[model samples]
Target chain A: MEVLVTRQINKYFYEPEKFQVLKEINLTVNRGEFLSLVGKSGCGKSTLMYVLSTMDTDYEGQLEIAGQKLTGKKQDELSAFRNEHIGFVFQFHYLLPEFTVLQNVMMPALKQSKYAREDIRDKAMHRLKTLGVEEHAHKPSNKLSGGQQQRVAIARALINDPDIIMCDEPTGNLDTYNTHLVFDIFRQLTSESNQTIITVTHDDEFASKTDRIVQMSDGRVVV
Target chain B: MAGNRFQLTFEIAKVHLLSKPKQTIIAMLGVTFGIAMFIALVGLMTGLNDFTEDITMTSAPDIHIYKDITKPRQSILQQIYPNDMVWVYHQKPKNELTKVRNAKKIIELIRKNELVRGVAPALSSQVFCNYGPVQLNGYILGVDIMEEDKLFGIKSKMKEGRIEELLANREGIIMGKGLAQKLDTKKGDRVVITTPEGYTMTLKIVGIFQMGIGVIDNVRCYANIGTVQTILQQDPSYITDINIKLTDRHLAKKIAAELEAKFDTKAEDWETANATFLTGVIIRNIITYAVSVTLLIVAGFGIYNILNMTIYNKMKDIAILKAMGFAGGDVKSIFMIQSLIIGVIGAMAGLLIGYGLSVLISKTPFNGGDIISLDHFPVNFDLKFYMIGVVFGVITTAVAGYMPSRKASKIDPIEILRGQ
Candidate 1:
């Protein structure tokens, strides 16, 4: 079954005279497929990803996740759904700098779900270990290295066991070592957990490792 | 969800507080100042009021009943009141006690109130006394022979020969020390008490009294109701207007109101009885009210400024709380609580300070004599003023804090994160 699908999606920024950013893009991802969106600057990869992840919904499209229609719901619903059904790993890590690594990873599930107290902590800790950043659990998230922060982001993305994971230039700002470490976590999601991860990256090596790559130019899918 | 809200909110509020300690201190000071103003004004007004009431009681006694005779209403009063409103100043011309109206009936009515300490009918008339052609025309108050000493504080100031002689002899009269000297009459000398009706009644000087009020001291006389009643050729039962003294001075007004509504329904209170005295009280009341309002406004503004600064400083934290799904109402509550606390603390402090100041002012050692005696300045703190001050601060600050905090809450998270 297709875990995610977008048909004829069009997106625009609210201001600046409705400059269209994503135009009539159609895409589908089956269960457990690793999809990579490859593009240069301002080519709508992030815009498309924002729509597909249901974060930015000021768009015209028929989007479905796990067979539930996703349209016209308010911001609060979209936010909760995003927390529960999908996860995001932003380029900057965006791990609330005030919190510890353990707290950061537990944020999505802690906020949106009511699991057992021990289960929540265990799941958060387990994901941190899976990404091999368990030693940094108690440290402030911003103190982590670029590669380590990206790893923590990936761990946070999978902490809720979300079926789909989206990354926006997940390794765009990192050393080569951190870049490879982020990719290694992505590999673990695809092969071991059947997490359908879509990463937008300009790094060709990272793009090549995905099962299929979608290329974009000037706000549309080119090939 | 609530836990998440609290944890996030608690963290944000703490950071907000620590970030601007100076503003917080300023807000606290604002609340304190507001409270202090309320307390001081209330204390001063209440204290002055107490002092005035004390003067009225000490000088005039608890209960005074006079004839409610209709006086000619002046035409000048038509400007302030309707021409139809009858005024009273008819001087039920104090003569011998026996010539007055309903004196015994009024006394009987007064005795019904268990609180009555004494009731004495008073007869007043002007008289010329003869001491070998050096005649002095002075006022005479003919009271009950035995009870004149009990009706007022007159006995306390008796520069006397005797006050009890009214009970023993029909010719006995109590004259003032100054009047006695002026008339050249010593004790046992006879003075002819002349009636306005061209009658002569002789009285032997037996006692003298000196009230501190110079007018009352220099030209007044006291004698038995019988001495004046017999000389006037009127009914013996109809003495002058009845005077009542009560045990509790504080209950005077309540008793006065009750009596006005019951017996002397037409009579005004001594508090409101004399037109000149009433006007003075009304003026003081107006001044006190103006002072109270001004003080409250100052306090209110102080609260307002502090809360405004608090809301201004907590903008970021308010945005965060809103993003965490807190309603605008919650944001308002948080700031309101803080301001309310500040108001309460300041009000309590002001109350203490005002009370202390009132005490200090009371002990102010002018002796209340000399130049002129006004007894002592009494100070009292009324609870209503304290409550009013608290409400003023909390309410004003809360209303003041409301708009700013709401503005903070409505801030867009995306814009705030962008540091706008």
Candidate 2:
């Protein structure tokens, strides 16, 4: 089944002047597919990623995710949809520094509130263990190394068992070793468990190793 | 599911507040002192009100029954003989004293009422107290000593001499210690009273009392009802006033109205008799609350500034919270809960502090010769004052927290993440 489909997407930035950022962009991703969007800086890849994740509702488009039309939804409804179906990994890790790694991972699950607290805790621990950060679960996120924090952030993204994980330069702030380690985790997640991932990246090697790469120059996508 | 969401939100708020311990403490203390001052000031104001009520009520009867000053007979005569030209020209004296007839029957009727605690008949007349060359104008109230003592607590106020001696000796009188000082007389000395009806009599001073009220102490004297009636050249049974005490003093007004309607006489309760004094107390009460609430709101502003700064600094975390699927409303409640926690803790601390301060003030003694001499300063520690403080504190804190929380909630995640 198609997990995400965007039709005739158009976005603009009104600052300085009415400037078109993305024009007539169209894309689709299949279930369990691992795709990378590769582009140079200021090529609208991050903007497309934000639009696809339902975080940027200013664009004019038809966006259907997980078989549900998400266009023109209220912010709360979109938030609930993101909580249940879509997870995000940002470049800076964005783990709440005041919380323990386990707590940070459990935040989205707690927000979902579909399961008991104990069940959420157990699931959060399982995700931490899967990411090889369970031993550091009780430590505050700010106390972790750069690589460890990124791994914990990825674990947090997966705690809700979301269908699609959208990462905006997830490994952008990491060393090559941690970058490859995150790449390996994403590859294993898709191949072993059918958890789809769409990542926007500037790393040429990272894009080359993905199942498929959609390269962009200016605002047009070229396979 | 909704309940679980609130738990998560509270956890986040708790962590955020704890992360900045100093700011949170400052906010809590602002509310604390605000509430403490509210309780303390209200306590003192109400305490003074109670004290004034006690002093006024203790010295005077709960209800005073006197003859209604009758209007001139011309109006009634004209109504009976309307358009009679000769009656319209006939007018009676306006300043004539209207005496209460059948005083014995009215006293007997009031004494039988279940609510009535004491009833005493008194004959009051303005007289001149003369001690050789020193002459002072005063009013003499003639009373049955025992009944007056039960109603007015007069025996306890005696500075010298005995009130019962007035009953034994018809020529004896009890005067205020201040009046005795002004008249240059003492207990067992002779003083002359010249009545308005031109009857002069010499009376031996039997009791000297001090009520600590300047006017009453300086110009009031008491004598036997029969002696006062004889000196004023009136019937032995004729009395100008009937003073009453009730089981419940607060019910005096209602009962006084009833007595006025039933007996066709003027009845005045302590509330109406001291209307000006009560009005002053009420105004003080209003001023107290106004000042207290203003102080509390000022403290609320301090909380607002602190929370505003915290939210500004935590913009990134707020954006991340939203991106993690917490709705704007959820984020707003998280900050509100933090303020509520601060308010509740501050209120509790403030109540304790206020109570301690009140007890401390109550222990401090006021020396004699001050405005009103008392063994200690009066500070009422009423629970209602503390309750007002807590409620005011929480409301002010919530108002203060609202604006900053709204700013935090509206933070756009895309905007913050785009900074990367």
Best by lDDT: 2
Model 2 misplaced stretches (Cα beyond 4 Å): A14-17, A217-219, B67-98, B109-118, B128-138, B155-165, B180-212, B246-265, B367-371
Model 2's chain B yields a TM-score of 0.89
lDDT of 2 at A43: 87
Q: Candidate 1, clashing residue pairs?
A: B34-B299, B47-B379, B47-B380, B71-B89, B71-B90, B94-B124, B97-B239, B162-B207, B269-B273
Each candidate: what lDDT?
0.69, 0.88
Once superposed on the true structure, which residue ranges of model 1 sit more than 4 Å away at CA?
A1-223, B1-11, B54-70, B73-99, B109-120, B125-238, B243-266, B274-379, B416-420
Q: Best by DockQ, which number?
A: 2
For each candidate, give the interface RMSD after superposing the true interface residues on Cα: 5.4, 0.8
Tens digits of per-residue lDDT for model 1, B1-420 = 567544544444444444567766666666666566556655666676566555455546456665554533344556567747756554354332334356577678788778988877777777777777787788777776566567666667666565666568778888887788778778888888777777788898887776645456568888876667677765567455666677765577788888766764343345544457557656776876676556556655665666677666556545433333344555665666555555566666666665676677666655544222445555566777667766665666666556665665455543442233
Error of 1 at B67 (Å): 4.9
lDDT of 2 at A110: 94
